[model samples]
Target: MKFTKFTGLLFVFMAIPFLTFAQDWHVGAFLGISNYSGDLTEQRVDLKYTRPALGLLVRKDINRYLSIRGAFTWGIVAAADSTNSSKALVARNLSFRSNVFEGSLIGEFNFMDLDEKGFTPYVFVGVAGFGFDPMARDQSGNWIRLRPLGTEGQALPQYPTRQPYDLFSFSFPFGAGLKAILSDKWTLGFEIGLRPTTTDYLDDVSTNYVDQNTLLAYRGQKSVDMAYRGDEVTGKLTPGTYPADGTKRGSPDHKDWYAFSGFTITYRLGASSGWGKVKSARCPVLRP
Candidate 1:
């Protein structure tokens, strides 16, 4: 299915509970850094490519130690093999940048009473769905979407194993954070969350290079040109130098991963109203 339609359904599913629960809620915004790990990243979790990320979240407290949250986040993730010091990677010279949009529903478990006046560490785990479009710059520096180019012989009858990847996929998100009560109605938090995704094409580089001649015949010269980007760094294309069909282009054993680390400031909804008072009385130890 298209990513937009899937996301719309996810929002509707999460929103239903909010309308029915009528519980204590907190609305917050976060600013942080995001990064990716995959074949193009040379297996290094480098901070050099970290990009700005922002998110909005709504949390409904189930008690002083547990809560449910729904969040939507936007971030940029990128990496380049050209920047690697390894000779093999520098020669590969592949790179990509993608904008990621993620929606998640998570359960948070606080190690201590969250309503207390001090700080507590918490862990969260949930299901997330995200959409990404990986892109790379052409010789002329124009950004070109890589998926449609069939860089790895995707969607071709000859390469049945190299099927096209979907732009939207599911993931498992789990992370830990610390939160502190700043006032009666405000809380400050810092967290780092990791997403282990189901797809390996987050960087648009996975599996082996296709037979150049066949790729050219089926997908056009642009596919053959992008299938192996080594020429981009060498400045000269060597005829018949492409990796043979079925030769390794990227590791297929491992999937991609992305992470976000940031700070959040939240406003406790209905903190001064009768509902708030009743909630505070029911959980007296949680009063901030």
Candidate 2:
């Protein structure tokens, strides 16, 4: 009971800031492109393409040099075969549209103190947690079916042949942005960012499979060869043939990272740092 209580308290402390940010959030919508650069790129996948992301920021200014900010963002991410000719790659393309949700705690640093500033420039760094889901489409435009990779080791009821929810994963976040003082109370800005994760399959390109009959049979040379076929570099396969041994199961072997940037418009509230309304310098001499 003591352990349970302690754990509950810890979770509450972590959630307090997130709850506060939701109430007085600074909402903004901006569009920018994102792409992947790790293993998925080497496996003939299109991981880099035009994508857009949107986010909201909730900030608390601590002082001239530091402050805290929380944010939430969602977007589409993909990668392409950069080595292949654009025309050829498009003809034989395999792409997944993965959705991601991320939350971050950022620290702001002012290079020029508020008192010495004409234009204040700042930098930030932070950690974040994320959730991602990858989906693929067939020639008919319907999503293709999938099962978790390596689930063969589990029992039938415990391991589904095809389940949609298996593709989600968590990640670590880091990024930097710049802010400029437009007025005593208003600021403008832009930012670039990145998130790294331990999961190798964000595109469902990893793992292999065997056809239903061969898989259930669980024996013989034919099924063995079919299952291992996914190991081939070319990934060549006949549509109706028994599943190859190398038939991929999960997301591809690639690093997941995206780049995004946009302008920020901010309105400050309070009297600190000349943010309040300027009073008239010429007040008539008080009562005679």
Candidate 3:
């Protein structure tokens, strides 16, 4: 699905639950850094490509130890094989950057009572859906969208086995956090979460390199050129030299992963009353 359509659906999903249950809500915003691990990154988490991330979240408390949250996050993730220490990766010279839009529904489990919290550590796990469009810079310095170009010969008759990847995919978000209640109405926290995605093409460099001639015929010359970018680094375009068909372009054995790490500040909404009192009153008294 298109990213815009997916985003619209996410907003609607977030709105419905909030409208239905108006009490025990905590609205917050977070600021952090984001990164990804994939083919280009080769399992190493690098800080050089870390980019700023921000998000807005809404939480509904089920109890002092349990709560559910919906959040919308935006971030940038990028990596380059050229930056790797491995000679093979440096010679491959592949790279891509993508902006990520994600919506997550997570359940948080606090280790201690959150109602009268000074500080409590928590863990969370949930499902998330995100959209991305990976882009690479061409020789002319123009950023080219990789999906339409089919750099790996995807969706072409010649390579019927290689299907095009979805622009939007699902992921599992799991992580831990620490929160400190600043007042009855305010809280501060820090969290680090990892999202393991089902898609391998987050960096647009997965699977084998297709025959350049086949890609040129099926996906055009742009596919042929982008499919094998080693020449960009070598500066020598040897005729008929390309990654042979069936050669590994990426390790298909593993999937991509992205992460968000940072701090959050939340404001409590609606004063506790009646049944809400029983829920909020379970905590030990706060010490001065």
Report the lDDT tens digits of candidate 1 across residue range 95-184. Answer: 899999999999999998766436799999999999999998888888989999899989899888778899999889999999987766
Question: Over 4 Å off in model 1, which ranges?
Answer: 1-23, 234-240, 272-288
> CA lDDT, every prediction?
0.85, 0.53, 0.86
The best candidate by lDDT is 3
lDDT of 3: 0.86
**TM-scores, all models, native as reference:** 0.84, 0.60, 0.84
Tens digits of per-residue lDDT for model 3, 1-288: 699999999999998876666557989998999999989875656787999999999998898799899999999999987788787887888889999999999999999987654679999999999999999998899999999999888888887888889999988999999998777778899999999999999999778888878888878887777777788785343333587888889989899999998998988876632332545657888999
lDDT tens readout by residue for model 2, 1-288: 999999999999998886654432333334454555443354322433657777777677666677677777777676533243543333224455577677777777777654345456677777776666655544456653223322222223333553333455555555566666676656677776666765555654444443544455544343233223222224343223334344443344455554445566655544334432334333657886
True-structure RMSD for candidate 2: 9.5
TM-score quality measure for candidate 1: 0.84
Error of 2 at 251 (Å): 9.5
Off by over 4 Å in 3: 1-23, 234-240, 272-288
**Residue 167 lDDT, candidate 3, scale 0-100:** 96
Q: How far in Å is the alpha carbon of 123 misplaced in model 1?
A: 1.2
After superposition, candidate 2 runs with Cα above 4 Å error: 1-31, 42-48, 80-93, 118-121, 144-168, 207-243, 246-255, 275-288
If ranked by lDDT, best first, what sequence of candidates would result? 3, 1, 2
